[model samples]
Target: MKTELIITTYNNPKALNLVFCALQDQSRMPDRIAIADDGSGPETKAVLEKYQSYLPLRHVWHPDTGFGKNEILNKTIASSDADLLIFIDGDCLASAGFIERHIELAKPNAFSTGSVVRMNAQTSQNLTEEDITSKRVFDAQWLRQNGNIKGLSDSLKAGKASQSVSRILDRLSPVKITWSGGNASTSRSQLIAVNGFDETMRYGGEDKELGSRLLNAGVKGQFLRYSAPLLHIDHPRGYVDPEIVKTNRAKIEETRKMRRRWADHGLDRHISA
Candidate 1:
């Protein structure tokens, strides 16, 4: 299958650079890396240009529209012809086996969801390209000694030993299987069946809402929380609004009540019949 990695980014070039550095070391590289850019400036463009040689990139950008992540995402999805679409946030650093793991677990009628180890500002700022290239930054012990560890859970998550535990936990874990924006994968057919993401949604619950629609369409979720780990580079979210989040939550509820499969305003408009 033609696999593509869809990374969502805004104006943060610094973190996006780090993300590129990590992708440079992927054990299994995607056929294409699509940047679902949400109206970023030149700095982000520069970052994308820098990694063009290192990564197979498809930069999909819109104008400086406010809070149009879903809209841009719809455009990106509609533009892509890849069979499998794996998603990650631009701030998240992929492990070497990240893409490999996603492919290993890919199944028909299902999407894979993974979790992240949140890096603190101190750790995030202190990271260098060398740290990522050498893969020392992925080590739980190295992080605890040189940087900050959120808790024991963070340590457990960062450890490579967690792979064995992840298989068990994936089946035993009680957490609801939702499409986490930080890390997730689904087939293009599955996404198109649900008509892609809802353009009306804001940031909060937008990813999960799409997951719910996929579920309504009889697509299941596969948990890979511990198996496919990512180091999330922490950054300030100035766009977050409590009222907007509440409104987004209500939209998700409406989708649930209706058990809707197709998005009212999504990829359909962008795709030619």
Candidate 2:
């Protein structure tokens, strides 16, 4: 299947370079690397220019335009020519066999996916070797080998639980939802039917909202449990709005409500695993 690796970026040239290096090693090289970039600094452009001469790459950029990731992503897909679309952060590095694994899972009405691990740059790990899968993640090998990566006994880690939860809000198996936006993939047709993503959303909740749409669409989602293990480089979780947390329950309820709305109107169908 013709596929495109879509990476969204904003102000992180070093991370993008690391990601490119990983892509170069993919067992199955993507036909094209479509960059969905919001307004990044000049340094990022320079880096991209250098890489463009040697790789099958495309750069999609827009004005700072304030919180326009969803919009940019939506348009990028509409303009691209790949049947399947794989989304990864520009700062992320693909496992050696990442592309091969995803292609291995391509199926109609079925979206193949993988898990992401979170890591930090301040760590003392080997950036070159460990960077094969992802730099930010520390114990990526163990997690990928075991088919799961978890953070310290804290809250969110690089494993099946959060990765699965981040993708979906309902109790759907296979299509695991996750909070981390590092590892996730779906078909281009499915995305277009839902109008891509809700552009109104700015900060967080994009992934959850998208998952809700998928569940409603009856597209069976399956976690590429053993295939694509991603490293979600850990970053400092900044202060979120008190209301976003306080009204968390209400948000879930609202999500369910919207899910019903989509289903009732013959819009999207939700499937169980």
Candidate 3:
């Protein structure tokens, strides 16, 4: 299947650079990539331009609107034409087998969500493009030496599990699987069926709301926590507002209570044929 990668970003060009370096080493490269830019500046555009020659890339950007991640993502989704869609944050560095594993385990009528190995601010700051390109950033020893050892065991367990073990964990894990925009994949048809993400959503639980809708529509959520692991670079969330959080949470609750299968303020309203 033709798979397209969608990475959401704001102004963190440094982190995005590392993410691109990581993607450059994917076991299975995506057919295309679309940046879901939420009003970033010239720095991000420069980063995109730097890698444009090496990757099949498209930048879907708008004016600096305040925290319109869902809106930008919806626009990116509409712009992509690949049958399969893989989503990740621009600050998250994919492991070498990330794309390969996602494609290998992809299922119909279902979306896959994976785990992240988070880097602290110090560790994130210290990482270089060489570290990402060589995948030394995912090395347990490197992570430990860099002060990311707190969750090393869990990170290793998730990143190194065999396919059989991963499948077993997926089947038996007690944790409820949710849609994580950072490391997840689903077919374009399934997303469109549910009208993509709800544009009314702000920041918190927007991804989860879309997942809830998919679940209500009988699309299963497959947990890939032990297989498709990625490293999330630390960054500040300056846009997170308590009022917005409360509003988003209420929207999510409403979607759950109503079992909404389609979003009124989603792709249909923004996407053109």
Candidate 4:
């Protein structure tokens, strides 16, 4: 299947740069890469320009409209022509086989959800483009030497038992596997069938709401936690507000109760002439 990688970002150019660098070593490269920019400054653009020559990239930006991630992502999703879409956060660096694993596990009428290993601020800060390109960022020994205390459990080291472990965990884990935008994949058709993400949602639970709708539409979610692990760079979420979280939670609950399949205020409303 033809695939596109869509990364959401605000201003963190450094983290985004590392993400792009990691993509350079993907076992299966995406047909295209899109930045779902939420009114970031010029520094982010400069980072994108630096990698334009190396990757098939595009930038989809909207004005600074307070936490419009869902909207920006909808626009980015619409802009892509690939049959399959893989979503990841700009703050997360892809594992060497990230793209390959996602593609390998892609199934019709089902979306794959992956896990992320959190890296401390110091580890995130010290990482260089060379480290990412060389795939050392995923090295457990290097990560441990550089302040990563979370060992094998959260490590991205894929082993021969990885697939079996992922399946076992998926079946046994109590955690509800939802569509995590940080590291997830679905076909463009399935995404549009549910009208993409709910624009009314601000931040929290927005991605989950979309997953709920997909489930309502008969698209099951498969967990790929062990196979497609991503390295999440630690950063403060200054934009998070309790009121917004409460509001989004209410909306998600409403979606769940109604079993809504398509969002009223989603991608269709943002389509350009």
Top-scoring candidate (TM-score): 1
Could you tell me the lDDT of residue 173 within candidate 2?
39
Candidate 1: count of backbone clashes, pairs at least 3 residues apart or interchain: 0
Which tens-of-lDDT digit does each residue in 1-273 have in candidate 1?
889999999998999999999998888999999999999999999998898888999899999779888888889989999999999999999989999999999999999998899888888988889999999999888888866577756766687456778777677767888889779999999999999998888878899899889988899898887778799998888889999899988988888899989998898988988
Candidate lDDT (C-alpha), each: 0.88, 0.62, 0.85, 0.85
For model 2, residues 81-184, the per-residue Cα lDDT tens digits are 88988888876667666777677767787665555555544431335544454433334454444433344321233333443453352224344453224566
Cα TM-score per model: 0.96, 0.74, 0.95, 0.93
lDDT of 3 by residue, 30-133 (tens): 99999999999999999999999998889999888687898888888887889999999999988788898889878898899887888899988888988877
Q: Ten residues in a row with the worst lDDT in model 2?
A: 263-272
Candidate 4 per-residue lDDT, tens place, 1-273, comes to 799999999999989988888888777899999999999999999999999999999999999878999999999988888999999999998877889888887999999998787888888777888887676778767777777746556553333246667667655656687888899999999988899998888888789999999998999888877667788999998988899899988887888899999999998876675
The RMSD of every model to the true structure, in order and in angstroms, is 1.3, 7.4, 1.6, 2.1
TM-score of 2: 0.74
Model 4 lowest lDDT segment of ten? 152-161
Which of candidates 2 and 3 reaches a greater TM-score? 3
Residue 262 displacement (Å), model 2: 6.2
